[model samples]
Target chain A: MLTLAQQLWIGLTNGMVFALIALGYTMVYGILELINFAHGDLFMLASFLALTLVGLLGLATASGPVVVVGLLGVVLACAIFAALINRTVDRVVYRPLRNAPKLAPLVSAIGVSFVFQNLGLFWGGLPLDVMGGGLAAAAPKSFPDLIPSTNLLGDGAAFRITAKDLVVIGSSLCVMVALWLFVTRSRLGKAMRATAQNPLAARLMGIDVDRVISATFLIGGALAGFAAVIYGLYVNTIKFQDGYQNGLYAFTAAVLGGIGNIPGAVVGGLVIGIVRALSDQYIGAQWQQAVVFGMLIALLVFRPQGLLGANVREKV
Target chain B: MLRVEQARAGYGAVEVLRGISLTVDEGEIVTLIGANGAGKTTTLHTLSGLVQLTGGRITFLGENIAGVPAHELVRRGLVHAPEGRKIFSRLTVLENLEMGAYTRRDPDGIARDLARVFELFPILAERRRQAGGTLSGGEQQMLAVGRAMMARPRLLLLDEPSLGLAPLIVARIFEVIRELSKSGVTILLVEQNARMALRLAHRGYVMETGAILLADAASALLENETVRAAYLGE
Candidate 1:
């Protein structure tokens, strides 16, 4: 037995990533009332962009904070990329269907996902980056274990936590908090919520609701781009096919967190992450996927409104 | 201050307000009374640009506002507080009022207008920070009217203000309307409560089907026999 503390630590560290990706899914869904199915693929594509950039820049040759700065630069680049891709998706796929049949945008989202995946495959080919000499072969690379463990909490009890784990947790918390505040505090945020509630009423209030929806896509894309940086560092690999599975999982995280609830995404992501880790540790790696999805099914069966979703009574 | 000429409009295929023409002189409280399906609400929606006018012209304050976007029409001082309250439920009463002056640039004047609305409905002043959805039905009606007043419109379009209020609340709302009319804010009131409406209206127009059936002074319509039998129950 690996001990409860060890499992708890592992679960928490992994949970941060889910929380980040899940936030993107929930935010986009809240504003548009349509899932951005291509969002995860967008994150995957962003990581690939970072890998390509790292290869071109020979970032591994640098030392100390330079490597970190290079990593940040890649993140920034991908943030811009995600924002652009998201904007294009909105303009091309969702905006035209704003007043059309609701299913049109949803189906278009799935089509966009496939199209994005194919574009990635076309660029990087079918081979997973890990397959060809792993990720180190893509560029001169070294995994920067920034934090040396300390025994501050009574020997091993101290956080045994590395700087990278701290980075992931801190960054995810920051992004989540910023997004929550944006939706609740700012004028544009209020407009977005108003539009979500009733677009016709929002328009009468002089809110350019179309503009708010576009901004929503832009914000969702930027956060996903940020998550890409964290994901690349944690996974240390990239592939064209990675997007579909990871994107679906993150979207599942969002649905689990109560599709339209903002904070629910964070809770959902964490729960999914811990459950996956536990299942992997005790139930064996092969059964991990089955275990995680089983929890989802059970949760759905008991509570279809989701963990934090509102039970709105729509008049027939 | 408001003019509609030969207005032809309707849902996609079926025509409702066919060739309707009417005028509201500056500072007059004009009321439109109609039976169910009499095109009263359609007329209001048409005037506010909610229903697109197919073959007509609307000039407000001497500007061709026939086909201006709905939001822009509001900035031009023709504010429509629609039939339903339509308050942004999640927003607080104060925030909803603030949204009323969304297109205004004069912050000070907007503030004054907000203060005036709160004065007009002190209950709203007490519940300024409360979520609009939490208010009683009567309070929500006041919030809707307050929100419209936040626009400080030269002309106001009120659609069925007494639709779903208690008799007492309905009486209070009419009194407020009378006060508003005295204060020089032109109103185009539409209502199914013909008795109370004409009692408060300076002049009333009765619509049957999609066309005007009768128009006369409020006192005349109040005593009109067919009007008494069909509406006032006198």
Candidate 2:
């Protein structure tokens, strides 16, 4: 049997990663019922941009404050770029279909996913860049131990808990909590909820409905981009098409927790993360999809409303 | 003051108000009483910009406002409390009231008005923290009215506030309306309960097939033999 510390460590790091990606899925689906299929890829693309920036600026080997600031610059650039791109998606794909049939926007999302994936491939190509040979191919970047103490928790025979894991887990919790407060206490957040509940009533209340929708996409994209940067630094590498699998997993988390509900999404993420980590430990990685998808299907069968969904009476 | 000159509006392809005209003077409680599909609710909706007018003109306070967006109308102090008590279900009674005052910047004054609403309907204050959805049909209607009043509107458009409520509750609501009218707020009330409507209104319009069939003082309409037999249940 695994020690309590070891199990906790695994859960924490894995949970952090899940929470980050889960925020994207939850926020997007909250306002727009469509699952943004391109979101995961968008996160992946952000990581790639950061990696490229680091390599070009020679910040990969830079010392102390320079490396820290370089990283900040990368994160900021990625976040801004991601938000802009997300806003673009809202304007070009989602907004036009605001009054159209729902299926139209959904189909367009799938097409966007492919377009982004191919664009990444064209840039990265088949062969990885020749700088660090297989090292660059295997791991695009390695963050300095910025997380302070990776070995804070007592070590064990099987799994070693690190400061990095603690940092990841802690940050995700902070971000999620912050998001909760923003949505509940902030005016714009209430406006968003109002828009979701009754667009007509919200419009009557003087809310700019279109602006609120656009803001949702922008914020969701920025969070995803920010998560991508941290994920890259945590895992140390990301492929051009990394978003597909990550996006799918995050989407599953959103659905599991209850789409449109922020707290539910976070809970869903952590639950999925723990389940995936436990499975990875015992049942081998390949069995992951079978287990997760099976659970998802079963949940749907039993409670189609998800963990926190209100009884939806919306008819097609 | 409000005026509709040959105003026409409807749902998509289905016309509900066909060149219907009506007027309400300042501080007047004008009631439009009609059968279910006679465009009473539709007329109110079109006045508040909820229904799009296909033809004719709507002038409120001497400004053309036929095609103004619904919320914009609220901003301009023309608030609609809607047919169903469309109170935000998830929000608490207090939050729902706050949303009604979204266009206003006077927090202290808004707070004072809220106090007045609570004073007006003590039950709503008792359930201030409760979800607006949990209220009884009557309470929801009162909250809906209270919410509209929070907007500090010059003209309040109430569509069938009496719909789906006990008569006692309906009486209580009409009393609130009586109180509001006494305080100088212009009201345009639409209702299918013609007897109760005719009793409260200064002027009354009888609507049929999306057009006005007759217009007269409320007491005059109440006494008219045909109107009394057909609408007032004589």
Best candidate (score: TM-score): 2
Clash count, predicted structure 2: 4
* Prediction 1 TM-score vs. true: 0.88
> How does candidate 2 score on lDDT?
0.79
- Clashing pairs for model 1 are A153-A158
lDDT of model 2 at position B152: 86
Candidate 1 residue-wise lDDT, B49-130, digit = tens? 7888898888899888877878788878888888877887767899888877776779899889988888889999999999
Off by over 4 Å in 1: A1-6, A126-159, A311-316
What fraction of the true interface does each of the listed models get right, in terms of native contacts kept? 0.35, 0.42
CAPRI band of model 1? acceptable
Using Cα atoms, each model's DockQ against the true complex is 0.47, 0.47
Residues B136-225, candidate 2: write the lDDT tens digits: 888999998998889888899888989989999999999999999998899999988989988999999999999999999999999988
Q: Lowest summed-lDDT stretch of 10 residues in model 1 chain B?
A: B82-91
**What does the lDDT read for residue B79 in candidate 1?**
84
